[model samples]
Each structure stands twice: as structure tokens, then as C-alpha cells.
Target: MDYRQRRRIKVWGKAEYVEGDSALIERLRIPGYPAKVERAILFHVEALSENCSQHIPIRYSATEVEAMMAPLVARIEELEQKFVGE
Candidate 1:
């Protein structure tokens, strides 16, 4: 018999689009119309702890997801280019 622990991530709340999520958009320094960025949907990412089986929210914005992924996307592109000898 084997006992394994499973960890999961969950979105605690429904993603919502707010027309003026300026405070977050500004804080992230996302360049674009503040209102537009704010209008993007937002949600909470939660981590499930094995011991507690409770969802603990991780503070981050759904709007900034693109911004956060930019660097990784660039890196992947670079890697692909290198692999292709380009």
C-alpha cells in the first residue's frame, strides 16, 4: 500500500472584469490604457495544503497574466530559435 499526497491549485472566486481596476493595473505598471487593463477579468489563485485541505489565495492578477508570461514567452522563442540554429 502506498500513501501519496496530492497538491492542487484552485481559483477561489469567479473571474470578473472591472472597468476601473486601476490600483492593481497601476501597481503592476502595465502599460496600456489603465481602464482597458482594469477591464480585464480578475481572479484569485489558491493553493491546496495537504494538511489543512484549505485553499490559500495567492495574490496576483489575471490581467497581468500576459505581462508575466511575456518574459517566459520570449525565452521560449529564444530557445526555439537556438534549437533551429537560427
Candidate 2:
């Protein structure tokens, strides 16, 4: 989910607000295979400066991503509970 905040990301002499960023994973199953093939998707945040460009890929392993996202997820949940009065 993208947070609607006044955070700006600058690139190549131009600046743009951070639209959003999300993590995704891909898995595939093969015929007669005993296990599913899994892959971690690597992607760069895109921005339009002089032209459309991509930032450095988030090159993190699955475990690392989970560890990094935990606090953020908990914070979001806490905020949600507060907003809904739960």
C-alpha cells in the first residue's frame, strides 16, 4: 500500500512524490514435479525525471524482506485499529 504523504523522491534534476511501493513474489508448478519453483521478484522504483528511470532494485532476500516489513506492518495495523476504534 502507498502512503499518501509529502515525501519526495528526486532523480536526475527532477523530483516526484513517492507514489507507492509493494513487494511481490512468484511461484510456479511444473508437471510431475515434487516441489514448486519459487522466485523472488526484484524491481526498482520508477520515477520520471528527464525521462522515466528506475531506481536501484530492492535486492533483498525473502527473509530479509519479511524482517524489514514486520514493523511497518505492525504500525499499519495499529493505526487501523486506532482509526476504527477497535
Q: Pick the candidate with the highest TM-score.
A: 2
Candidate 1: regions farther than 4 A off: 1-54
- Range of the 10 consecutive residues with the lowest summed lDDT in candidate 2: 19-28
**How well is each residue in 61-81 modelled by candidate 1, as lDDT tens digits?**
666778899999999999999
Give the alpha-carbon lDDT of every model: 0.58, 0.51
Going through the candidates in order, what is the number of backbone clashes in each?
0, 0
lDDT of 1 at 51: 39
Off by over 4 Å in 2: 1-58
Assess the local accuracy of residue 48 in candidate 2 as a C-alpha lDDT between 0 and 100: 40
Residue-level lDDT for 20 in candidate 1: 68
Quick one: RMSD of model 1? 16.8
RMSD of each: 16.8, 18.9
